[model samples]
Target chain A: MAPIRTAIIGLSSTATTSWASAAHLPYLLSARGRAKYQIVALCNSSVESAKRAIEVFKLPPETKAYGNPQDVADDKDIDLVVVSTRVDVHYETALPSVKAGKQVFVEWPLAHDVAHAKELVDAARVAGGRTLVGNQGREAPPIVKVKQLLEQGSIGKVFSSEVRAFGGTVDREALLPGLKYFTDRAIGGNIVTIGVGHLFDQVQYVIGEFQNIQSQLQLQRPNVLLRDPSTKKVVETVKSNVPDLIIIDGTLAASQIATDGANVLFRFRRGQQFPGDPALSWTINGEKGEIRLQAFGGSSLHAGSYGAPVTIEVHDFASDQVQKSEWSWQSWQEELAIVGRSVGVLYDKFAEGEFEGAPSFETALVRHEQLATVLAGWDEK
Target chain B: MAPIRTAIIGLSSTATTSWASAAHLPYLLSARGRAKYQIVALCNSSVESAKRAIEVFKLPPETKAYGNPQDVADDKDIDLVVVSTRVDVHYETALPSVKAGKQVFVEWPLAHDVAHAKELVDAARVAGGRTLVGNQGREAPPIVKVKQLLEQGSIGKVFSSEVRAFGGTVDREALLPGLKYFTDRAIGGNIVTIGVGHLFDQVQYVIGEFQNIQSQLQLQRPNVLLRDPSTKKVVETVKSNVPDLIIIDGTLAASQIATDGANVLFRFRRGQQFPGDPALSWTINGEKGEIRLQAFGGSSLHAGSYGAPVTIEVHDFASDQVQKSEWSWQSWQEELAIVGRSVGVLYDKFAEGEFEGAPSFETALVRHEQLATVLAGWDEK
Candidate 1:
């Protein structure tokens, strides 16, 4: 029962702004994570970058430094490989780890697109590799509470649900230098695929998978300016093909329990939320009641990341009363970085052999395929 | 303009319970309405019923009583005919009035089916008759403000809009004796056609018509109990084929100004609003700002009907400020019944010959056709 040795790819040094540093490191470096997981290696685009990250983050001196995904995959001591890079590089890194029979964890999107995601899923199955996809929504407190309420019939039979949300954290009119590549659709990491995709996964995870979907994706904002944060000067204006607005309506897959194919209506607009309102407003309508989740600052339900505060309420039809739902996270989660709390919960579940409760590569494949269909349909349009 | 002598068909005497009495009589009997309209005749299923209504409502002794629609339509002294009966009778009553070349006003739904609605539209066109459809949403104060703001570019170029609404006033588990017929799909006066239909017209009035629509209509509550209100006793349990849940998403018709084919997502559920929440929540997302309208207590946007209070706010992205919108109604409208405010406005517009500002039979046809398409698709499924 030795701690599982882990190697993290693309673990950046800039803790103030980097996703991997801010979201992943805080949890893995914590006492709870220390007892369950041991950092064995760091992988970057080059050996120098890997060594620099190790030095800047003050990792153990014996931690192996690797220049590429293959080098990390070949490290016999590493029991787990975590792919924490741009979505476009997900398949390149995770596929090698899966083929090498290491437990793999890839940040959501699974890969740049469906074809690559499918290949990784196929590779994992062939190698009999246990895998996890970084869709933290599966462990988010509000999402978990909603799912439990639904299963317990707190709302009776859900007939329909609707979500109106602000989709992106980036300023509507511009972006910062390091984040400018987010405006490019080709990287497969724009708002539609990553930001909205996460929210969509949360919806399906709470209720059920969509049986059929019809969507309209609009490139409402086609040109975006990239500026330097310190100088506050525009460096470049880039053309964007990604859609800033998305409207989807569909029916949930039918279930054995009382005509469970509920209707769904979702709309997401890129940019900040309206001045005084929550960024995310979701309502699940049922025969005997309703459950509403409102996140004030950020629409993406990555727990409290993006500085959003969430409130969950259930309105029971018979009693004509609305009750606030109370949920709790591990005390250690509060000690981790805000963005890393859900990740920490996820890691805890993984350590306790709660694989079924977490989303696997196959789970990621379903979401990835749904998004791929949406994007493909938009391209055809 | 000698008060456009009018004949009202099916003006029920049950002022506290009847739609025509509660919604129409209050306005028509008012001082302002009296100055523009004079009741020349009363039409009902029987001449005795018509006489009873006129007597109970205390109309002038000279008011003629008629047994059928043809009797009112044939009266040369009558210049206007108002049909306020059930949906199934709309075509029968309004058709003869249109063919007789008298201005006609029909409560919304227009007819029981699309073919009947089409015939009425064609008949009105061929007869050169002026017609009004009782869609009061066109004149609701909040709707007026939203429309005005959109026209004035208060929210900039609109990219998308979302509406989540409670679609019916009836209790989810049961219905009253007088309203039991509403559960019958064959009558075509259920939540889908009347409740949700009214809200749909309000959306299209502010934005443009849907260019393409995808909808899922569900009859989640198939067997609803009918009860006697006073005794709280179950009268009957009837099977309902009508949809109690509806989800629609689509793209607006293309416009010349700033790629104006905005995305729309709409969801409506029958029965009461969730406790402590507004029955209707609408958001129009734009480039520079967002406009939100929230109606508490009732979902139907018939001004203050159903005792719902509405608030309209605009969030300017540039200023990051939320501003409440102010709108006004005619002074005389305050004296009418609560549910009759918007109806009073519509009547005022019609009397002023401001036909463009009021919804005509042609306008109702477009809404009816859209709903027809939705119902047809659901039936096919």
Candidate 2:
């Protein structure tokens, strides 16, 4: 009720061009979401940097600024801990806070692998704390409406589904110092776990779940160029062990297409956004109706997944035409607009206590397990 | 070169609704194609019926009309024989003509089984006769353009492909006397061979062939309601052995998606159409670009495959936008317009002798064999 007192990790003092400043800080600071969240504490690499964040982000002069996450975790005033550090350190930053019984929210790729993700989930359960992973792909309005349309039988029985996604972290032709680690497969933040993983989670959210699947992953761009963040120029070329292409094909747990299984297919590619193609496209085929959703926002499955309106269309056998829904499905919120909009949705749902079961630790764990299944032959590929 | 004198088997006197009157006769009659083909003979179920076809089709008074295919085959004036009878009878009707050394074109599903198609090809080969089968799906202009685009590297290094098709003969809820035979799987003109086959052929025409594949077929619509040919009302019910859904997933003979294989997926369902959705949709995703083709013309694999334009769009990393080509890809050639357009394309190409290889009798035989591979577990389903 008291505006869940918050502490966001790695709150940069330099007013850096970071996701926290671009998405998280502005979102919680906005007048609209202000009533539900209040930043009480901030942490950076050093006490001096935290002090800079307080001034740059305009936190109250009295607000606590700490050099370490443990100091924030020790502060009894904070009710929530928001982890926005690099993927490699997400487990370390969020573990102590969750262990201290604070509701915790971690940016996706909850950890580099299923083991790390499970450990985080286990820690939260042990501490009796709540969790929210940054899997915001399904929180977008068009995505939410798809769930509604399916429930309303806008399309009779869904027989099959398909999804196509392109462009994400894999597009990092030359990355900054912080992002160089993402090119390593062991880090678990590459396209496979973060990009395809998020979209697949959204698919499961909209339709159902995958009962069985066969998957393929390929490293099309094996050599990744690393750049100095300040110079914005390539400094080193590293071998990329992560796959840039991802494919999953199989049956959905429930389907109108068949009793044994419903046909579902997915394909994802990285470092590629053909000029003018929708960033995300999906089709749900049904017996009596059909639905399609596409986003041209250059929306990737990773950290930044939005820019334009997520368009939704419906077609029924009776009308025999694809009718773009009239419902206003756009979020006009300016910066980080698309992903921000969905993040806002999750915040609202959390505020209303409707998201208690998920974006929760358990659901995130299940997705992690599925990603593990897809990783079975990753080494061989 | 005085226009190959032609005989069309099963030319219908019922100008009211025969496929011959609607598609074949009008197509050949059109001035554009007339220079290449001059109808010299017509044949139907009986001599009386053949005379009716001559009257209805307004054939020249000197044109020969025969009740039996053998009589038409025996005519020395006929240089090419075209068979348009039911699938079950195609083998018999086209046999004598092929053996007699006439250039022959048999409607697709050259027979209900592989053996018959092989026999037709064998007879044509031994007689040193040219052959064409009415597997006209690829002949469509848009389809032709797709092939051209792929060859031009519109999408570089094709990594994967997906195709979805719905609506066709598998929808036989009610049987018209003439079409009741389609409800029988033994007839082999059902969705798997006719529907998936045509689309797959189009794929081959564009992207080469599949080196290996796994397939699934389901009789979702197992029992069809028989109907009066004229009434359009259900009059009886019959068992349907044919599958309404077909699924194929495999590696292409050549792919840019991978070194071992580029992923390819195909799914086809029958008697189903979402109001505004295209009847057939395909996407080619490549390393550098992507291409999508969607036909709304309710374009099933059977006789009539359009209700809308076959839309084509290409996306390249250089362009980064989906550019729909501006081409008059539609035909106002009403009866069997979609199929007719392709047939016209073939006729023009055939006129120039460019279609020397296929959809020849031998090529059609290959497709029938593939369908046979799909039909292996038909009884269980």
Candidate 3:
């Protein structure tokens, strides 16, 4: 019944604020997470930083400090290794842990490329290591509700679906210093593999997986203005080859068998401005009625759809009533930071020894392969 | 400048309530209509019935009663002839007026067949007579608003669009007695030609017309149950050969030339059960943002999308606001009936000599030809 002993790479000290420091650490330190996970070691780019992390985050004196990922992965006391680093460094940091036979959780854009991601998947499989990636889609409460309703036939034989959303990746006027490399499509980290990939996974998770699909990707906005972090002024206009627009039209396998056959029309744009933003609108049209999810502001398909105030509306012909889904996330909200509540749910699943479909390294590998196919198909026409 | 003198063929008296009586008569009798149109004649199955119509409807003493459509069409004082009869008889009732050089308004499904509709178009063109058919789509206020918004670049460069709705036909339990003959597709008055035809016209009206398209039609519901007039009980079940489901995917010429092409995914289902009714949900995904129309009740593609309570929502990325269209129908709603208000708008268009897109016979012929293509294509696939 002891908690899973854990070590985290790129663990910044409390003196600095970062995604790793803000999103998962607080949850792990909370009452519910406290009973389930125990931090046993820390690794930073250097030993000085790792030592400072122990003091700043106030970890136990016995907790080891390591300067590199391999040292942390080699520690005998650690049962799980967590990698929280830049996309370019994910392979180097996570590969060691997979080889060490420790359960690992890596944040997404699973790796720099399919080759690196494949290496990680192969290592984990050979070592029989448990894995998790931060896909965090199935954990969203609204997604869960929608999936349940569809399975229960709330709309009665769904025939078609449509979605129009913003990936929020091309917010050119609002880029942080660290995101400059992300704009380079060469990094394999644009909206397609990151922002939209999360949403796409959710679509496949909620609706059935796509049996056949054809897609068009367009980089409509050629030049993007990067804002200065301190002065908040446009400093540089970067040429972006990464696609800001994605259009997909294909039939769902479920609908293909029905005499009427159902399909999907999905459009995800990049850099949705606030005033003119239609955050996310998805509709499942069925034989009896429809279930619609319209998020008014900042609602992305990935983690953002679970943010407070996401709306789920159902117009049921059988019941002859339009109803809004009712849900609660008090526990999640209590422990939440800027990161979404689904991460906590992710932690809970990992704690319960559940790994399937929870963004495991294997899941990320399959998604990476799908992304390669989409990128390849975009050039066919 | 004088009020357009009008004669109505098959105009039922107030002793019997019909679609014309409930939807148009009230509007025509209103003060605004009184100043613009003068009813000069009425035609019925017989002279006695015509006399009863005059007495029951309380027409002015100047109004003449006739036993046949030919007599009404031949009247020198009648500048316009309105035909409100069964589909099988539309050609017979309106053909004389076309030859007589009177501006004529005929109910939808302009004729029992495409050949007949083409004949009417040809006859009207040769006679140089204005003609209106009851497509009644552009006349709907919401449709007009959507078209105006799209034209104004409300959602810039619409690259993709989707619509999932029902034809509202094959609603075995919701049919009235007069619609009994419509169940027979051989008459060319079924959902494919009527329900979906109305919606398809509206789609083209808002977006640019489809430059190229293909379709699939299915007779999903093979049999329909008819309800009794007096008891509202299932009185009989009849076999149906007409298709109640239509699926179309095609590119709008607008998107084909743009870097990101705009396309449409449309599905019209039949026999949608209610309390779970999903009548209509349309999403136009563009470069700037999206405009969505979601109807709760019987919001089919035809006249239903323009009903007062129909919801039109817009997320304009340019404006940075998600908004619901604020529209008023004071002119039409003031004359609203238990049926709907679109009919009054249709009447207004006919009276004002605005024949361009107000469901003109030419437009109806085009739609009929389009329907023929769809039926032919359905067989091909």
Lowest-scoring 10 consecutive residues by lDDT in candidate 1 chain B? Answer: B252-261
What are the runs in model 1 whose C-alpha is more than 4 Å off?
A14-16, A256-258, A306-308, B14-16, B256-258, B303-308
Evaluate candidate 1 and give its CAPRI docking class based on DockQ: medium
All candidates: DockQ: 0.64, 0.28, 0.13
Please report the candidate that would top DockQ against the real structure: 1
Query: What is candidate 1's local distance difference test score?
Result: 0.83
Worst 10 residues of 3 chain B by lDDT: B254-263
Give the candidate number with the greatest lDDT. Answer: 1
Q: Which pairs in model 1 have colliding backbones?
A: none
Please give the range of 10 consecutive residues that has the lowest summed lDDT in model 1 chain A.
A252-261
What lDDT would each prediction earn against the true structure? 0.83, 0.73, 0.73
Mind giving the per-residue lDDT tens digits that candidate 2 earns over B58-94? 8898788888888877888899898988788999999
Candidate 2 residue-wise lDDT at A219:
63
* Least well predicted 10-residue stretch by lDDT in candidate 2 chain A: A327-336
Candidate order by TM-score, decreasing, is 1, 2, 3
Give the chain B TM-score for each candidate: 0.96, 0.91, 0.90
TM-score of chain A of each: 0.96, 0.90, 0.91
Please identify which of the two predictions, 1 or 3, would achieve the higher DockQ against the true structure.
Answer: 1
In order of appearance, the predictions have TM-scores of 0.96, 0.81, 0.75
